[model samples]
Target: MSTSKGSSSRTGSQIPAIGGLDLLKAEINSKHTDCLKLIATNTEGNPSVVRSYISELDNSSFILTWESANPSLNGQIVFDFKKPLSTKAEILNHISGLADSAITDLKSDTKNSVRLEASKQRYCRYRLFNVPGSAVTWFMFAFAYYAKTSTNPISPVSAVLSVASREFFAELFKYAFYFRIFEGIVVFFICLYISSAFPKEISESDVIKWAFSSVLTGIFSSGAIIKLARNLVVSKAKSKKIL
Candidate 1:
């Protein structure tokens, strides 16, 4: 494709704009990552209470406490920070949510089951529908001390990866249970609905087809419902905002 001089000039002009957008995105992501790392690590990148819960400092990964749950503890950040906005309150609110989660964990029974430091009596055994069984249940329980959560300063990705490695494999055998009864029940029901949608009476081929279809439907439907619920909560919170 050949570009006319006018087209080439316009294209050149747009490069700076593109570069600026990229830079802005990098800045925001870097900030979020810092927040997450701080929430996960102490000054030494070694949390004293690493075995107590899951802390998400990034989109894809999380720090599992001895009592952790959801893989993305950073979900609130994902939705709130996705688009452009300039409100100090919003950022503070997000951090407040993180702080709230830490305090709430102490009062609640959830995340304890996954704790590496859990007692034998409280060891929880459950399944996440589509996720690999080892990845979901076993890995979480076995690796409770691999990450930590707190209000410490954040660090670079290289530092985070280093901490994860050092803390990764101390498990010859350790486990426990952290029960979030209400949230756990909701999760169970969602899984049950998806599972029941695919009848076992069907042949292997049919069952596979039904399972895949059901999973897709379940994910989209449940996600939409959750999104609506979150928006409602956010709206109510914003309504109460003085600004």
Candidate 2:
């Protein structure tokens, strides 16, 4: 009886065993190669471990050694064949299938983990402050109003006159100021949500500062846009009356 021993230097407690000496010899002989080697990973655990081999032919049995320190998470079968080179294709196919399945499963698990994290983030945002949805709705309504009024156009001269008029300013102040307050609140909540999403923890003072800055920006933006829109509407109406 002849025997061969293989050894690998890697970190871990577990290692894979060798088997199917008969089949491996036949394949190596048929291929007329000095030796054959194969490598794969075991994917059943939290961190998958690699399994690799260097093989040498003995008279009746082939020996396999593990290149890595840990054994596979799950035990795998060692292919054995009685007939020389008869099952070579089958054995290769089986190994290929195992490798493909392991890779596919790993990719699927990673994708699921990402999706789960995203869901958690969305839920937290909703629970903490549901401002994005409200902001989106408000913007949609404003867009619709603008779209409806845009059909009736006004000249540049009329637009300037409308902005200068006291009546226009009064209406602008009445609606724009209130809308600015709403916009400021929306901005404050948005800033809070964003700050919470960061990995680093923020202090109450920092949050207040963020809110103040964001609200100020929102007020300026909303006030200017609303003022322009109201002025355009007034200009269009005044021009129509004159015509």
For model 2 the TM-score comes to 0.25
Clashing pairs in 2: 14-71, 21-62
Question: Which candidate tops lDDT?
Answer: 2
Question: Which run of 10 residues does model 1 get worst, by summed lDDT?
Answer: 1-10
Write down the worst ten-residue block by lDDT for model 2. Answer: 1-10
Task: Please give, for residues 1-243, the per-residue lDDT of candidate 2 as tens digits.
Answer: 122221222222222322343444344334422111122333223233334342443222223333334443323323332222212233343334444454465553322222222233321121233367447535544543444355553564346445574345434544654565666577567646644543212333555665565456446655655665666678778989999
| Model 1, residue 226: C-alpha shift (Å) | 1.8
Per-residue lDDT of model 1, residues 140-160, tens digit only:
432332332223424543465
TM-score attained by model 1? 0.18
Candidate 2 residue spans exceeding 4 A from truth: 1-111, 119-166, 186-210, 218-243
Task: After the best TM-score superposition of candidate 1, give how far the Cα of residue 189 lies from its true spot, in angstroms.
Answer: 15
